[model samples]
Target: MSDTHAPTTRLNKRMAELGLCSRREADEWIARGWVRVDGRVAGIGVQVAPGARIDIDPAARGHQQEQVTILLHKPVGYVSGQAEDGYQPAAALVQARSHWRGDASRQRFSPGQLRGLAPAGRLDIDSTGLLVLTQDGRVARRLIGEDSTVEKEYLVRVAWGEATVGVQPLVPPAALAKLRHGLSLDGRPLKPARVDWQNPEQLRFVLTEGRKRQIRRMCELVGLKVMGLKRVRIGAVTLGQLPLGQWRYLGPDERF
Candidate 1:
């Protein structure tokens, strides 16, 4: 006997696949009667065939447009997420008083902007630079999701062994090559990275993966000690003159 299951999928999943919203958001909209299938309101867990027509209420789109993304020039000492060991989280710096005066965007600071806003990616307590916090789930998923291929660029200060007279304390070319490809952390090989020297004391790393303390660990593996690490860019967005401990809105035209 032949099997006879139709190729159907959950309504929420289909909505997410269509870039309308995330599955969770789709469920919320469905519960709120903001989603429709074949011109009728959809219900939670509803499944439909491949040809089903999905419609989202215009109000849902407006609400999504109001969601905000913030780019913080995080200073060292604050954890990226929750407060830990008495160290404040970077989100605490997003208050109105802390808004960057140099911000060219017309967006105004509001208390409601803080609600549900969360860090999209992490910056180690000891490191500093561009850190993203957002209320938009789509932006978070785009930047830190499992399949995200966004590149994060960092400038890391390193120290090799103490310099001796007539000798340089620099990482060898062979080791630098390894930083570009050959390395492992947590018993797994790392993805290939773009590692190059920015100056005598610093290395510029462009990586697609953000493992825990990853840059520091990568430097350690190459026999270099990371003295300071600062993320300068995530995808096309840059830290670009945003003063430390201040934030600015991700502009309308900006992506990633």
Candidate 2:
């Protein structure tokens, strides 16, 4: 944010416009001395206006800007964001063959969007379901960009070889089966998840961010092993029976 009353703007406002962080968060960081401007520690009262060179810490910058923003019903074995050891990028699944239209004007897929397209977030190669690819900067910035707080939902199927001679875990075996739950993979203690059962062997997952093998890891913590994983939603958008390995542009009314 830039300074005010001194021909500059408040620091928090500047940070928000640059997509560095939310103004509220910037204020907190400034108070905590975590932000600097031009090598000088920034205070909450500091002012900066547009075009001033700002240096936010690298971790604070976060990966940003989805180029295409297409959502795919990813099939297992297609990696979400990267082309990893013998794994193809889930992004590769997007082709002209998959475009569907409710509004013809928006149906025009630009080659520029295609050539510049890539996944803003990830879905591991072994996991499947709703994966988003994007070219829209706002969606990318909001969903995969560093300051993103979008929620993702999934359905997980799990199996266990044995129970510890105890009744069952409080985490719930029934709830773990085809149920909804939350996850965190940054090694921070996870946010509370809403877990429930859809059947006996499946658990639904809703996460705010993607961490490496988060659902699988969470299942392990509960003594269950993941047999299958599928993301069903992201934000308010749903996969809605879209076939695996197929993709479609998000609808205008969709709220992801």
Candidate 3:
């Protein structure tokens, strides 16, 4: 029996895998007659062999360049996505008036910029600090895709608690060590995390994965209750001095 297989893939998936653009972006380009395969404009749902050459029109490239990423200093009480339980999404805070005046990026705020913008990663409603929102699908995939490894840093304030039997008031060194490498949640072992003390009452956590309420749940296992949690950084970007409830453009030179 032969082990060989066809060397072709969907054009949109190929483009996304190549980091050129996302599948949706590729579809948009295809609809606009802006994508070419082997020097001919490709149609939607087109598939190409591995050796096929793909090119994007300059117009599509320019339009992609105009897509924006935003860094928001999300305040507690806003959901990361659509409104839930009567709380508005963090995206609601991204109006012209909410744009940070100190933003170094010269792109002026416009209502059009908000169209199709969505959160790349989630920040819990009870948590506060840096939350990323973007109109670029490539950015979204890079930050939250299944294979994404970007680090998200948080400062979590905790209190000693007596909730679980046999748990201590002060987290022991052994438990802290477990937090760094030996913890499981939802029946799966969590990825190794960087956990350490930022202050007596706070823990600094650097995790490459974002599970729902992960930090709070992790602390619970070690006999601590999270009193407050704030995300401060994602990848190479930091919250910096961006005021709470304000947002700013991700500058041209900035990369994840």
* Best lDDT among the predictions, by candidate number: 3
The models' CA-based lDDT, in order, is: 0.88, 0.67, 0.89
Per-model TM-score, in order, reads 0.91, 0.67, 0.93
Candidate 2 lDDT over residue span 1-256, tens digit each: 3333446678887776676655665776678777888678888878775545666655443423223367788888777666879888877777776664432225556566666466767777788888877655456668876666788888776676553222234345544542234433455766556666556556666667666777788777656777778888888888886776667777667767
lDDT of 1 by residue, 164-196 (tens): 222224557888999999899999999999988
What's the true lDDT of residue 250 in model 2? 73
Count of clashes in candidate 1: 0
Error of 3 at 211 (Å): 1.1
Q: After TM-score superposition, what is the CA distance of residue 184 in candidate 2 from its true location, in Å?
A: 7.7
Instruction: Summing lDDT over every window of 10 consecutive residues in candidate 3, give the lowest-scoring window.
Output: 161-170
Could you tell me which 10 consecutive residues in candidate 1 have the lowest summed lDDT?
A: 162-171
User: How displaced is residue 56 in candidate 3, in Å?
Assistant: 0.6
Q: Give the deviation of candidate 2 from the true structure as CA RMSD.
A: 9.3
Q: What ranking emerges by TM-score with the best candidate at the front?
A: 3, 1, 2
Residue pairs with colliding backbones in model 3 are none
lDDT assessment of candidate 2 = 0.67
Question: What's each prediction's clash count?
Answer: 0, 29, 0
Superposed on all Cα atoms, the candidates' RMSDs to the truth, in angstroms, are: 3.2, 9.3, 3.5
Instruction: Identify the superior model by lDDT, candidate 2 or candidate 3.
Output: 3
